[model samples]
Target: MTARGLIFAAPASGTGKTLVTAGLARHLRRRGWRVATAKAGPDFIDPTFHALAAGKPCRNLDVWGMRRATLAGLIGELEAHADFVLCEGVMGLFDGTGPGAEAGSTAELALMTGWPVVLVVDARGQGASVAALLKGFAGHRPSVPLAAVIFNRVSGNRHAALLADATARHLPSLVCLGSLPADPGLALPSRHLGLVPASENRDAEAVIEHCAARIGTSVDVERLLRVALGSTLSAAGKAAPLAPLGERIAVARDEAFCFAYPTLLEGWRSQGAEVTFFSPLANEPPGADADAVYLPGGYPELWPDRLASAQVFMTGIRRAASEGAAIYGECGGYMVLGEALIVGEGQICPMAGLLPLVTSFAERRLCLGYRRATLRVDTNLGAAG
Candidate 1:
């Protein structure tokens, strides 16, 4: 298929790639272009912002959690839906799990999908040195081609001209799309997990509008659109979402349990499974007829007391577990399934007590990585390995 796509990558995180990508999505959508947006890592927050900006359901293109076929199928779904697809890269373009590990990096996705990457550089302090950085990024991996460069947090036109002229002199092959000015107000507010969830942000639409207005004035939308449309990936027909865990699946979705992957939910529907949702924070419970319940990861520690006293929700979960309904938890959800949770010093809250696990958030230790495991027994997910 001749569907075009572009990857917005940066030298590092916090370099304004998300803002630029969101802004560009809105700008293009306003011009009557059907834009498909995707995030290039295991992030759920950015995609929400992307969806708000593009007026479409944003999807994640994670390299670590998905197989090549799965990624290809998701891209194909986008190709079938929208004329142009724009993706925001994670962390640094090449920074990933290991020194050449291709599982969870933007560079790997670029190579896998053959999508051109536009380097989003933070140009707050340096001038000519910006060219040096772009040169390194362009040459660091010969397989990953750099289509263009857009400088973020630029001081003024003089600074942008310096970056442009230097890039023209040193790396004439690289295109300089332009630069965004330094605007502290443009930064999105954040909680523990990065930007606050878009659903909770009262000024979310205003934020998107601000970014779109500024980006429309700062960047060359026409040239950027042409470049994105030129880099097309061959289509792989959409694959069905993973099979449903049960005949009727009940999911907990709230500020405390909102990290579920949209692809997984869509997959369940594609397989003709019925899916339902409830909010634990709102004292809601799973449907009485649900055969399975899924609690995804989120900030359970933030409201231990509220969750502990959620009698209706807690009782429904226990009742479901007693009825032999399949129950699964991930990360914070896993913590909530335990006997008790240590929220702070001298404070503990009783939990569902479904599992022999106790979680302590007071200590504040971080565990972050990709996991590989084989089920030792038959479970609702699938047969044992």
Candidate 2:
């Protein structure tokens, strides 16, 4: 099934792309359209907000992290399930891994899927200059398909009109969907890892609803839909990215371990693996019948006390390890499997102790990038080099 979709992108970060994308998704969903949402890159945070707004799981389409067939297969899955798919861009529209590289950028996704981009421009500190910004992006990569523009954070009606007039004069061919006026109420709370996950936010539904109402009234929904290009992707043969850990895999889920990729799990299921989930936050452990356990990354550092007190969960994890179950953890999950976790001000908390490691969050440092590694021995991930 071919689905009409568009990528909600921006000239740069903080241009309100996430909020606008969520708002528009909710807006379309409220109007009785089946909306499927996705995030452009390897971001775990924004997709949660998108899922909340769309009332379905939001998948990530990473050009770098995923294979071409996997990306095509995901888009095909979304298309079959929805009337419209809204994808929120990462960082900036053209920003990717390295200097002047478009490998993993939203533009690459647009080119791959043949979905047009609705560029979200922050109109807070500009008048006619908004036109120049539009011109630059529209002409930046001609093949990327910049179809429309949304002026976000406009100060007033007069400011909106100025943006409209400027766009009309300079880039008359470019569709200006409309402007979202600056409203403090439309803002979502943020933490060190970007916007707080929707699961942790009690007001997530309320926030989505508020955004829907505001954006529905402000943005030109009909015009936006009219400009949305049908996805050029076709369903690819189902291929798991990696072999399943075991016949039955117990996955750790909840606030502390919520960074598992949907595609990875789905891929495992496609390969005839039985997957189940348990919440460590609720003192739950992996299923007894499972032969493998996966602990994904999340905000475990923030819930040190709760995790330390999860006696049952810790015991179950230890039992799994003793039973020779294939156990794997990454990032926060790795922290949880350690002997001790050092929270703020040197507060030491006991952990599962599956690994002889001690982790600390006393002074956080941002360590972001890509890495390539070769295994020296047999591990849960793969065999030795």
Candidate 3:
């Protein structure tokens, strides 16, 4: 969409780009703009927040973990179906490693996407020296267009004007869209992983609404849009999300099984597989009497009673498994396929009974990390040794 483009960034982490991007997306949506939001790294939580703001599924545009071709395809594919693309860059403009031994970074994604940068500078605890920071950021990178600046956490009008004037010389013709003060009232809650999981927050809707209102009122949208629309068009290529599954598979998809990746589903489609989706918690049997069933991760523990009452779904699952339909699950899905899932209320709930396993979530310790796993035997995910 030639309409506009935006990449919200900062000198480093904690400068409020996530909030700014969320707010801007909300504001634009309020202005009747069809906003397409994306994150420039392998973050699950940020994209969740972006989705909340943009009112659409926000996808990740990681250059680091994905094949070059896959990355291009993801950017290009998501660029469709929106009036504008608002990409939120990862930590500071240049904070990332490459895939395996590859050298591509977030900086590379910006160049590849043909989108300009909107620097979000935290003006807190700084004065005229903000100029030096801008100079270093501008000079440290080449080929990345520094479109404009947004001074975040400014103390007051006089403080903002001074910071703007101080940095104006280094960023010739650069417009300070507006300054955001350090608002104690607008901060999002954090978790060990970062901002609290998007699924667990009640204030998320209000947070986005408030931030959007602030950004819409403060930032110069016209200037930002001009810079975004000025970017040269590039071909992002076609990359599918799902991996290749066999001929046909029945995928459990609903509130209980919603953590499946878009890429994985898309990849299955590419492999000429018929991936039918259905709900297990809603008492709906999977679509099609397929050769296999995939149950991905989600909050299955929260609705144990409903899932237990879903006899139709459980029976269908058992029948599918009995017919030699390969059954597989990950995390929560893995827990659900077990014989019983113990709830936090000390209640045991019946599951698909595919396996004689039981799971409990009363003592949850976050299992967070990147994985480097290889298969040892043939499973539904792929060919094993």
Candidate 4:
């Protein structure tokens, strides 16, 4: 049977969409359903929580960065493996990279996959006014499927009743799943990037369980399942997004290097590449026989002391580089490959010295968004532009 899917979106960010999505995924998984979760943008942190909750790796669906075929292939793969798929949207339901551009928005994903959206509205402040908000979202893009609504941070039964009555009166077509109460304990802690990586959170599983219990009790799980629609995507004859680095690739995997995209690795495997993982924080090095090494992005600055003291890991990577193994580093990984890293209080931390570069995190400067650059010369990434 084709897998049914739902897009858990919100009017804006911080509307408890991540917790709700994770909670619903866990709730369904506990009930004997094979639940698969995905984040609907370029997010590494949220997917970690979803993976923890769903007991599987969460793939990212980036409409802007990924081609249509790649997106279809991923959704197809998810459908083939799981009975149900839940996608957590990024930011607001309609918010994207630019004004009126649907490229990176949740609405775009919903429309593309023909998946019904379960709008999670934060009902903390107003009651009847929410009806107007719902109406605007529903009527904004007539093509996007807005199947149901779920009230979050609801005050009490009276508040829920007020919202429900307002919805029934103003928009009789939209379905109200249920309301989750305002519980401060349900909120996840955040850092500069976003929520702290699930691996770093000691009570990650407990937090997921708490969310699952709350959602299972509050939301109408049966109706929510019914509201999910099957994906309209077909992945027949779709090509992999990019070529693998080498036949055998060794990847850095630890708290500091946790921002690797699962889809990219999965694509590499699909293209007949062998991938292995090692932890630099644990003083582990890449496999000796690895033809290529990948150091992904993460909070390397946070563990500069541990990384700097990992002599074994440093020596191993240097050996690999000298032996002509393709070494690729992105963001935090690039920082580790530098000559030194200036972290907290301008402390100099010795790095792998693979690159004549130094990165400083002493004063944070947030540079976010998509970037496009043409390669100047032939390298591991691609040929010259």
Candidate 5:
């Protein structure tokens, strides 16, 4: 089942979306149904929290960051595992990045997937005007279903009743899922972007448990799940992977280097690579029996101390490369292969003693995009040209 139905939203940031979606996922999971959680944009942090809440990895449906055909195939794969999916929209429901790229916008995804909207509005200041807001958002695009409205930060029963009455008049058929109180405590921690990465927060597990339990108790889980169960999910294309580079490739998958695209790994496997995984932060080295090694990108900045101290992992990678194993590194992985990395807090630490160059966070100035780069050396990834 492809994610049959999902949530389209507004550009309202800090609206407790994390709690609401986490709670929704948690609620669905408790009912013995598998839930696949998705974030609408290029957000890696939110998905980790969703996975923690639902005990399954959350998939991203960013049109800008993925190939349309690849997106369809992965969605199909997840549909088989998830009874229904809870997709949380990024900043407002319409804002997206890049020039001439409305593809990544939540509105576009809603239209493409034919999923309905569950607009989460901060209804504190709006009394009768809430009706007008709902009307505008509801009528923006016709085929995009306006499934329900959930008022967040309502002050009291009277406030909730007032908003509900106005909303009913504007859109009589629309359901108000429920009102969430302005609980200052419901707010989760955030960093430079949005929510802090799940790995950095020590109390993250406890927080997810609380969110799941609360969402399960308060939200109308059964009905929402029923609606999700009714949606259709299918793949957009067939997949036939190319031949693998070698017999075995041990990939680095700890907190520091965990950024492989799902399809790429699946592609490698399909081609005949006996892929294996080991953690770098845990000090596990490349598997002794492996023919090659891979290091992807992640928060190598956060764990400079850990990565610097990861002697065995560093040694294993270098040893494999020295032995002419087809080793490779992506962005963060590329940084890790260098001599040193300067952490965000202005601490310089040594990394894997491979390349003689030092990488500094000071050099980070938004190098992210769907890049097309030419290879300069032969590696497990591809050929040198």
Candidate 6:
């Protein structure tokens, strides 16, 4: 039926949307409420944290990558599971691929799914101007509604009071749910890709709990819940599976290869396919009986030495390739499939050399964008477009 949900959004990146969303998920879950989580875009890393916080597998609701039917199917599935669904939005509330485009923005998601947004503002250096910003965002798109505002990185009670009072004076209809004070310990560690995936964060659980405690004390969880539950979203329905890759697919999964989406794998299973996991980082290869192999993106450059020296793992991959097992890779996995990978300080590490491709991490370049590729020939992904 109507699954109460909220999309955690911000004015820009680094506005503490992930932290607030995760903390609120944990806090609400601990208070005996079933919580489901999702990420607004195609982010593999943030969904892991969302899963850890909500104590369930998190799904990705991408506006750009996913078809409307696919999104509807996922929303149906989410509605089937929990009382509340907290989706953390990408980058900024209105930011997307191009100027005036809403394809991948949080605003687009809110407009599509009717999920009210809980905007988290970085209130470090502003006061009454915060009201103007909120008013602009709230009025920017008539179709999308801003449910509440949570001020993050507030200097102190004095700063929080100023922000709250100013917003109340200007946009009185908007609710100030909470204000998180500046805390160094609350910040998560980051690297070239982003925050270290939740699996590698040793203190991840403790960090979630600490954030939850803070959120529980500071945020108006009950009021926010009311706002979410007030929405009249339709019930989730049955979904058909996507095009099948193979009957038995081998998947790479580990700290070094942990970027695969849960929904994709779940879709594979729904199509009556068997999926097995092997860790190249652990020197394990794909199962001998696998019909196809999939390698998702991750930070393989960080573990060059270990990946290079995994003789058993590398040998098995070569054997599988020789045996005509269809293999595909994306980004990091593509790097591993190449002849060599150049990591830090010009240290070139030997890879499987399966493909005549060369990738260098040492010589970094920015290739950021939404990519569209047409099939050159008929392949597992389907016929040429």
Against the reference, the lDDT scores of all candidates come to: 0.86, 0.88, 0.76, 0.90, 0.73, 0.86
TM-score of 1: 0.96
Q: Runs in model 6 with CA error above 4 Å?
A: 229-238
Tell how far residue 317 is off in model 3, in angstroms.
8.2
Give lDDT tens digits, candidate 5, residues 164-187. Answer: 899888788777766777765566
Best by lDDT: 4
**Span of 10 residues, lowest total lDDT, candidate 2:** 233-242
* Cα-based TM-score, every candidate: 0.96, 0.93, 0.74, 0.93, 0.81, 0.95
Model 2, 265-298: lDDT tens digits are 9778988999999999999989888899999999
The candidate 1 region of ten consecutive residues with least summed lDDT is 229-238
Candidate order by TM-score, highest to lowest? 1, 6, 4, 2, 5, 3
Stretches of candidate 3 off by over 4 Å are: 1-3, 98-104, 229-236, 241-258, 266-385
Across residues 274-304, which tens digit of lDDT does each residue of candidate 1 receive? 9999999999989999999999999999989
Candidate with the larger lDDT of 4 and 5: 4
lDDT per residue (tens digit) for residues 1-385 in model 3: 3445678877887888888898888888899888888888767667778888888888777766676667666656556567788888887787656334223355666776678888998888898899888888788766777778999888988988888888776677666788887787568788545676566778888888888877777777877777775234336355745455557888887766767766677678877888888889778876546887889887787689999999999888888878788787886789889988887756888887878888876656546444567899877666785
lDDT of 6 by residue, 276-330 (tens): 9999999998999988888889988888899999999899888888998888888
Model 4, residue 172: C-alpha shift (Å): 1.7
- Ranked by lDDT from best down, the candidates are 4, 2, 1, 6, 3, 5
Give the clashing residue pairs of candidate 5, or none: 2-233, 9-93, 10-92, 10-93, 11-92
lDDT of 4 by residue, 1-385 (tens): 7799999999998899999999888888998999999999888999999999999999999888888888888898888899999999989999888767777899999988999999999999989999999999999988999989999999999999999999889989899989999987688889978899888888778878898999888888888888888998745435365889999999999899999987789879988999999999999999999999999999898999999999999999999999999999998999999999998789999999999998988877756677688999898789999
